[model samples]
Target: MEILQVIILGLCLGFVYALMVSGLTLIFGVMRIVNLAHPILIISGAFVSYWLFILFGLDPILSVPAAALTVALLGVLLYKLIFEKNAAQQTYSEMTVLLTFGTAMVIDGLLAFLFHNTQRTASPAYATDAIFIGDIFIPLAQLYSGMVSLGIIVVLALFLKYSEFGIAIRATSQNRTSAELVGVNVKFVCLISFAIGCALAGSAGSLVSFVFSFFPSRHWEWIAILMSLVVLGGMGSLTGAVIGALVLSVVSSLVGAFYSPAWSTMVFFLALFLILIIRPRGLFGIRTD
Candidate 1:
């Protein structure tokens, strides 16, 4: 029963983690450049929910869209002002790494200045509510957040399958030059992809606020965990991200339950190492040969 509870909890948390990395994976797939500032945007989302909850009494769940929108606008501004300028540079790939790293530093400092690094969690009234089923326990917050994450992933998948913009984004991701030759606005696709990624980050942040305590600098830890998941799942594969999140989250949860929460964090690195050793392309990574 205890093992069952742990697995269930792990699965729920895995869903949230999957949603967390969706944007990161999307941006990588489309732009072929990692946005190191991605985690900071996620933290910004948590802060957005935190502020809304404190000032307007809005629930964290209700604040998800607002958080997503705010960060998405920020994402657009970032792409237009910073990334777009370097989009055509021959060194764009390497440049983006430095650029995003610098951007992340700036955002981290700004958050610290505005929020003062205080540890906080957005706790709605239902935060403490739970469901019990024959000795199994499930927290309402985790259950709802997980359900919401899964639903959003499904919607995103469908949008990519059927929507015009989604088709364009997919085309650009597959082959930028070919997409442009076929009349796809590659630049716009990049911008939209970045925005979508940031929006997902914000949405994940709102969920994170309820599931865990967070602070301005907490993004450092999250970034490490998520990057590992991204790499483990395959650098640019959304399906891989979800699978990696589930695998690692369950491993971490089981370790925490049987061993120590302290060791659970190490599971990410261990799994990453093993996966790299066995499948360098990741579980779902495309073969390059």
Candidate 2:
């Protein structure tokens, strides 16, 4: 029963984890540039939700779209100011990494200056509330967040598969030069894709507004684990990211249940190492040239 409970909780949490990393994955998939600022964008979303609830008495669910769109707008500005200069560049190896990392630090520093590195949590009464069936229990906040995560993933999948704009995005992701040759506006695609990616990070943060305690610098704590999920899943692969997140989340949960909680943090690193050793491309990752 305890193990079953652990698995259930792990799955729920995994959705949120997957959601957290999905934006980063999508950005990488489309641009091949690792956005180090992705974590800070998530932190910004959390802060937005926090303030919305604290100052305006809005619900976190309502804050989702608000925060998402706000960050998406910010993402556009970022693309214009920072990524645009290098837009025509084929590879984003050293300079892009440095730029994004620097951007992350600047965002973090600004937040720290304002929020003072203090842990701020959005308190909605239902955050602690739970649903139970027989002997099983589920936290309402996490469950709602998980549902939102899954819903977003479904919507994104549909968009990519059906929408004309999404088709263009997909074509660009597959081959930017080919997409441009076919009359697709690659620049527009890149901008929209970046916004969508940032918006995803925002919505994911809003979902967890009440579930996690966060400080401005918390992005530092999250980025490593999130990156592990990306690497373990095979960078830029949505399915891979989700599967990898589920596997790592489950492993971490089980480790905490069966072993010392201290060892739970090692689960991700261990899982990544094992997966990399076994299949260098990850569970479902396929690199395209």
User: Model 2: per-residue lDDT, tens digit, 44-114?
Assistant: 99889999999999998889999899889988999899997886676664577888899999999999998
Q: Note the Cα lDDT for every prediction shown.
A: 0.90, 0.87
TM match of model 2 to true structure: 0.97
Clashes of 2: 0
- Clash pairs for candidate 2: none
Worst 10 residues of 2 by lDDT: 87-96
